[model samples]
Target: MTEDTLRSVNPATGELLAEWPIDDEASVTATVERARVVASFWRELGFDGRKQALLRWASYLVRNTDELTELIHKENGKPAEDAYLELMLVLEHIDWAAKNAKRALAPKRVSPGPFMANHEAVVEHPPLGVVGVIGPWNYPIYTPTGSVAYALAAGNTVVFKPSEYTTSIGVWYARSFALANPQLPGGILTAVTGFGATGAALVTSGVDKIAFTGSTPTGKRIMAAAAETLTPVLLECGGKDAAIVAHDADVSAAADAIAWAAMANSGQTCVGTERVYVDETVYDRFLAELKSKLDNLKPGSGADASYGPMTMPKQIDLVREHIADALERGGRALVGGLESVGDRFIGPVVLIDTPEDSRAVTEETFGPTLTVRKVKSVDEAVELTNASEFGLASTVFSKSHGMEIGRRLRVGATSINAPLSFGAISALPFGGTGASGIGRIHGEEGLREFTRTHSFARQRFAIPGMALLSFGRKASTVAVIRRVIGLKHGRHS
Candidate 1:
């Protein structure tokens, strides 16, 4: 039997905000089948037609920003202003997907190669039938929309399953899109509500691809389940991203950027700065500046606070555990420490002298916490930063060698002199390496992730004397081909 209702509650006050009927096995299968049928009509619309429909949906989001912002605040406990910013960024991504999809996915001619010079070749990208998206509650609109918008732009239908805690927000996304484009088929963009079992159903429900965002362990489970059907998956797992400060970095600017990145959204971000490496030349100055900034920051349920309560209650315990491990291993808190982790609202924390082997230094704390370590040089900083298996995104602040140093990071995205700036630009792809997950979302790479490509070639004419592809060629033709290959490639070796 299907579960009755999935309740969405406010993490801060434990208030039940809304309830949605959980989609069971039968419902989930039906939804996928419906999407498969609707995908034909969606693909027939072509890029320009789909672009218009997506633009209308973007307009709907803009018009209802206030309502959506409130829902996000209630569901995820982020500050209203932060929630609004997230909505605006999603709008930007939608616009990019709409305007660039046709150009990016359009068929293009390619040279046929030397042996088949008389042939014409072309490559085309086609939409995968239906895409399944499993979203996270943190930045619900922005994160899921990254997959949804690109999938729609690429002429594929979408079946979105948002985090259980933000089920209503997911419903609002689908409802708003439908209202904006009433002519669109119902299953072109659908939302299913449920827990982990529902997501498992989607993975095996015959979808072409799945885009998931959450913890590394959960990502592993999803991948294993998808492996049953050989279904391709794009896993945007979380990160223990690092921030490196060079000796030449602007002490104040670096401190401010790190502080904001660490504390924003209560540090529920996948690419947020969790560990920091500062060169010894400016280590003390950076810490002093960072501590000063953290002192003014406060976490609370009110909108006036710098950040709100933790969106996931269990994350608080993880934060406390990591901090305890660091402290027990000779780490000292320069700012708020173990006591700062409240029941829901976790205050800002800045730790120094944390051992390299400490949990705080190695794990994805996923909280408003920062572990700073002093390094002798930028190379040491890079080596230390790359120590973790989680390589999602990283940041570096340097005056003359910012880009040079950032290139050393083994992350999917890196920001120079900025914190998590890679996530703002719709043109830059976002994801991670190693345990941070695989595949990419956002930008041109994102549009391609939801589609497959096919290449075709046709012979315009045949050379009268050339029978190289057949056995009819003379022995001299083989000699001539050998000489040609020798002349072309012999010098390279």
Candidate 2:
């Protein structure tokens, strides 16, 4: 790989910000090999060594929070405040993984069956050699670090291929790892820069495991590619998450959550609530409150702005098309229309009277657009919410039955009287089911996800029955054996 070959363009301004090298196949392979060797040494360091090293990395992130946030903002086109939030979340994961990896991944004893009582059984978690991570452009640091930090804590070396759109932040992350521990090999925490081809190379580069975060289609492609190498994968794909506002819900609080969930980061979040199901009894009132809140949101790339431009310019057209399709199909835009989209940032959009089957409700717009639908009961709300092929995160607001409704919704995690709150807690497992993808990455599962379980059985001594089996066997011996076995294991009391 050569330096200063690829340029990083700011999506908000279309300006050339920075340039980086394009890592080729040879370099990627070499990096993977280096990771394999380093992983061996890292595994030997055990939980305490890895934990201390990760804590040092967390400290670095905390000490240089502003600089890291700035790089994230410049590379991903998010507001500085949101970038800071991302860094904070990443640090939380780093802290949690360091503290919990030992208990979560350590070997544990298991009971052997009576037939094998002379043997001792234990299961140990071993590192999966090298792990390849293909991260998304949105929430660059927080999203990938959920996997990267956990993988490291589990004793696996990582080769992270951040989205080409946010390669600078990726470089910054890898540089931080090097600065924290120079003894660590290059592949222990490596960064590879390129387009989709580079990501594809990482998935197929004979890695022990691959953790990917992106669209469903891209996830399917990555899974297919990994299948060729029989490598396990953890995919965090797209989600058309829904927010339900019951009649008993707190109107103001629900409105605030919906506004933040839909418009934050210009609604480029995978788990952002795109569709809203409001009880018909309070539909008008909820819509009014939501509209009032949306009206105050200002979209721009300035330091003080509430939201930033869409990180990927091409998504703007898709947002437009979805809105246009909904309008053509008898849907009405209550707050914003075609004029809401600008050269870079898109103003907040709230739509109502949209058909259930409209593209606006069914597909992932990935923009600052919220589609509100009226339902008669919570059953109807859950039906509409689960109608989509994507099932990631969801939110339900009901003072009386928030937990009930949340449990019924088909999503990985649900927030009651809140939005994206479940993800904020590093103790919970985060990932979706169905088309949203499989597997999890957080909490104890997160650490174990990057490791392979190894079972160890040690034979203590041979049983008398087994030793006498080849010596001699008689009818009386068989009767005695049966009686002993029956007395030991077959009694009802």
Candidate 3:
């Protein structure tokens, strides 16, 4: 394939799936400009029209779920079942956005401040014209749809750039969306394929906003490029999400949750559990149960496999490097170790007593490997978890105080008594706080993320005593405003 085209290879068999043309900077810019025209029409459709269109798209997705799942399997080397689950998640978001967008984005009356009682004020959310999405290979359908569904529901057109490792699946989505509405080809939703250059082109392509899901370093690069155009970018980046097991927690349940979180999708998820901190009182029990569960899980690109292969081949090396470093630093493997990381599938590698400073604990392994640490108390566990620079989402496995502990953790979303379950709840917002992400998706917050707030005020009648709003009214205007402010807010002081 030439530089203008990209080749999609199946990670499980190293077989080429297809060759697709890549969009250059000029083409990317043109795509965004075209989207702007369609965006105007889409926005004019109002919430009701957009909702109908999105529901049609969701229906198309549901009708073709089998084909889409197979495409994801071929392109990303994930199991067909997992791909189906991802599709289901995407459909849930689409349905939620369609049903909730009108209520979330509709203009609502708000009481004017105490000083302007005679004025009627309202707030309206207007579409952001066009949005550009840069999706990741792992969970490509679910991750990008988090942005695409919401943006469309809020009346914004989107230009999606799926990861080069999974370009065929991205093309499938674009085609299906077009099929949903034959009148709009590149207008409402479009897909661009390629590597990093194509994504960079999208970032600086004059879109109203860019929603990116990838590594923290790549997110920084996207932000920097978007800066050149003063474009707003919402980034869902890397994470070293931790699962904390309190002393009084259910050891078996926590172990099961941790095992699934760390090993699902071969541990390629951004919010997947990478670290586990258990109370020293029950750490041994938890570790034993976790190893027992993880040992039974298998990784392969088959129907019988518990999980699948690494979508990106290069991630295998990083997983190996982290395992080696952990072992070198006096860590013991409870399950699979360096030898488990193969060319395509990374078997479960469970490390125990790993040093805090080790690469396995510090860096995002992004593999089916997890490092378990023992802490004296839940307080210590929280401290250790918060010490990491990446705070995307966390899980607390305490029965009595799971919610309390979750609230104390500094992250975008927290799961109580479960592992990353917050992602499945369509009403909850999903995004990271620090390096995890910049903006949220999946709920009302997600719908608002693609739109801008416009405040409206119309004076029904004049307030005789409210003179501060008028220019050059009177010297008493300042006195009246100060007295009112003191009456309303000064009591607390």
Candidate 4:
């Protein structure tokens, strides 16, 4: 491929799927500037019009499911079923955003304080002119769509930059909107392709808001760069999510869920289970069940494979490094070990009794690996789980105290009795804190992420005696206001 073009290759077999000319700063800037003009047309469409356009795009995606799924598989190195599931999530967010954006961003009336009773106060959420979205290679369709769909529904035009690894998938996702809604203008949704440079250009392209999903280090860099222009950003970054199995947990169910969660999509999921903290009372039972679930699974590029090859080839080294570090630090592998980490496909690797300070335990593996630690009690499990720097999302398994345990975790979203359940629900907002990342995507929080809040206060009628806001206010008004404040607020004193 030429230096100015991107080569979309399959990680499993080194097959070249497609090639496209990449975007640089000049092209990305032009796209964003054009989107700024189109933003006016899209915003003027209002909620109802925007909803129709969004729903139509959803319909197109649904109708072309096979095509989209195949592209996702080819470009993302995910199995067909997993790619379909990812596309399913994209549709869910699109449908939800199309239907709920109005209510989420609708104007609302607020009660004026006693002193300003003559004025009517209202709060309105208007779309920021345009949004720039930078997506990740993992979960290519679903992750970025969380922002693209909601931003479009919220009446903002979007300029999306799919990861260089999955440029084809990103381009297809953006092109779908225009194909589905030819009745609308073209610049409402568009994509720019390339490596990090293209994404960097979008951040400084003067878009109203920037929505990004990627690694923590990259997310921080984007935030810092965007800060130069004082641009607002919605970042969905890294996660080393933990799954806690309490003494009262359903051992078999927890094992079954965690196995699938920790290995799905080659464990590249941002919210996947990377760490497991199990109460000692149930540790043996849970380990046995988990081993059975992970034993037969294998990675391949076929329809019947458990998952598929690692999408990013470089990620395999990190996975191996983490496993080697754990093994060298006195940890024993209960399942596959460093030997199972292939050049492109990594089998399931489960480490037990690893040092808490080990990189595998403290950092994000982003592979089909899990670190299991036995804790003295549920409280100890929570403590160890919360010790990690990443706090994106987590899972809790307990028959009786699941909710209680989940509430105590420092993560953004937690699933009880299930792994990664919060992600499937469209209404729940998804995000993280601390090193995990900033802002949110999905739900009302996501729709508002691309908007600006405006409060309007109109004078309905003037109280003749109280000219408080006028230049001709009487001294009696000040005296009356002081008396009212004393009567209302001083009574408790």
Worst 10 residues of 3 by lDDT: 463-472
For 1-493, candidate 3 gives per-residue lDDT tens digits of 8868899888989898999998889888888888987788888888888888888999999898888999888888778988898998999999999999999889999999776788899999999989999999999889999999999999999999999988999989877888987765457998988889999999888889999999999999999988987999899999999999998899999999999999998899999999999999998899889988987799887789899888888899999999999999999999988889888888899998899999998899999999999999889999999989898999998879888888888999898887788899999999998878799988999999999999999899876756665685877887777887898889994
Please report, as a residue range, the 10-residue window in candidate 1 with the lowest summed lDDT: 1-10
Report the lDDT tens digits of candidate 4 across residue range 1-493.
7889899898898999889888989999999988988888999998999989988998999999999999888888899998899988888999999999999899999998888889999999998888999999999889998899999999899999999899999999999999998888789999999999889999998998899999889988999999998999888888999999998899999999999999999999999999999988889999999999999999999878999899998899999999999999999999999899988999999999899999998888899999999999988888888898889999999889999998999989999998788899999999998889899899999888888999999989878889876899989889988998999999993
Taking all chains together, each candidate's TM-score versus the true structure is 0.98, 0.95, 0.97, 0.99
Candidate 1 lDDT by residue in tens digits, 1-493: 2357888899999998877888888899999999999899999999999999999999998998899999888888888999999998999999999999999999999999897899999999999999999999888999998899999999999999999878988999988889999987788999998998899889999999999999899999999999988999999998989999999999999999999999899988888999999999999899889988888899887867899899888889999999999999899999989999889888898888999888898889989999999999999999999989999999999999998998888989999898788889999998899999999989999999999999999889988767788879888888888998899889884
Estimate every model's Cα lDDT from 0 to 1: 0.91, 0.88, 0.90, 0.91
What are the runs in model 4 whose C-alpha is more than 4 Å off? none
Give the higher-TM-score candidate: 1 or 2: 1
What shift in Å separates residue 187 of candidate 2 from its native position after superposition?
2.7
Error of 4 at 204 (Å): 0.6
Error of 2 at 181 (Å): 1.8
lDDT of 3 at 469: 56
Task: In candidate 2, list every pair of residues with a backbone clash.
Answer: none
Query: Candidate 2's residue-wise lDDT over 254-360, tens digit each?
Result: 99999999999899999998999999998889988998898878887787788888888889999999999899999899998989988788999888888988888
Ranking by TM-score: 4, 1, 3, 2
